[model samples]
Target: MSHEQIQSCIEECLRCVQACNHCFDACLQEEHVAMMRECIRLDRECADLCAFAAQAMSLNSSYAKELCRLCADVCEACGNECKKHEHDHCQRCAEACFICAMACRAVAA
Candidate 1:
């Protein structure tokens, strides 16, 4: 990928990371937060993977594609977990994860 393309991907991954963090915070404010421990965990995992993917992309690393693919997988799983809840934050997080997963999948090697 060109520098611009890599930068764009990194930007998107950063956005995903932010969204996941927001969602996790929102989850904590819910009355059913105890039931959302796994969801929160997944959100954090996805965010970390996204950051890793962004780093790989930024460096033009040989593992970029593999990291992107892993990021997509984790984002999808996080999305599914978030979707199980009906809160507005969960809904928005799920959408963000979905978008990030699609983008990562499209560019993954």
Candidate 2:
């Protein structure tokens, strides 16, 4: 049902937020911190968007779909950035972002 779908999307968004947070922390600990500047920024952005999307969905807000759309965009961007890195945390974050983007799209649809 619609409610279930929204709940699923919220769960995915939360997972993405966790992954992004992990990736951001891992990136900061990388040897070449300067090289991960963009990755860190995108990770932060994606985490924030995912959290917002989850909150909006939980409240059944009028703008939930709009937030989901933005969340998907940020997730995709973060995934792409994480994909460029070789770290295991980055790889995991990328997968989470991709999955969350799909879940968000389902909600927006």
Candidate 3:
């Protein structure tokens, strides 16, 4: 895909990476840390994938579409996990993840 076509997805991926990272750190500081294990783990995974997907798109990699497809799946999983929690960070992360998933899906299609 052209750079222009992939720009929005790239932006969304970067936003997701930031949100996931923030949520991961915030989750660790919660009073009930044990309850946030899955969310934290998913946050890390989602952030990593989103960052990689953004990089792949920025570089115009041949596998950008595939990477984005996988990123979308991870984002959805992370969003679902985040939605389980009541913290502000988790809620924000969920919003970002869902938006990122949609952007990735559009690009992958």
Candidate 4:
């Protein structure tokens, strides 16, 4: 990967991680936290996926595309979940997830 690509991936990954963490925290605060279990689960998964994608891009690994695909999917899922909540944190997290998803798609493309 080029230096620019690595930098881009790092930024996306950091954003994703923050979003996921925020979503998880917001989920716990939801009135229906039980219904948000899947959301929280996917939030954690998305965070991990983003981290892996960033590492792959930085290392210029052949698996970067596959990792990017996974990252995109998880970000989409997390965004959908966050959209169901009206909390400011959830709204912010959803936006972050959307941005990361777009970044992942660009890298995958």
Give the winner by lDDT: 3
Which residue runs of candidate 4 sit more than 4 Å off their true CA positions? 1-3
Clashes of each: 0, 0, 0, 0
Greater lDDT among 1 and 2 belongs to 2
Q: Would you estimate the TM-scores of all the predictions?
A: 0.89, 0.97, 0.96, 0.87
Tell how far residue 10 is off in model 3, in angstroms: 0.4
Candidate 1 residue runs with Cα over 4 Å from true position: 1-5
Candidate 2 weakest lDDT stretch, 10 residues: 1-10
Q: How accurate locally, in lDDT, is each candidate?
A: 0.85, 0.94, 0.96, 0.83
List ranges where model 2 is wrong by over 4 Å: none
Q: Report residue 106 deviation for candidate 4 (angstroms).
A: 0.6
Q: How many backbone clashes does candidate 3 have?
A: 0
Task: Give per-residue CA lDDT, model 2, range 23-78, as digits (tens).
Answer: 99999999999989999999999999999999999998999998998899999999
The digit string of per-residue lDDT tens for model 1 on 70-106 reads: 8999999999999988888788888889888877876
Order of quality (TM-score): 2, 3, 1, 4
User: 1-109, model 3: which lDDT tens digit per residue?
Assistant: 5566599999999999999999999999999999999999999999999999999998989899999999999999999999999999999999999999999999999
Candidate 3 global lDDT = 0.96
| Candidate 4 or 3, higher lDDT | 3
lDDT of 4 by residue, 18-109 (tens): 87887787788889888888788888888888888888887879998888878898899889988887878778888888888888887777
**Which residue pairs collide, candidate 4?**
none
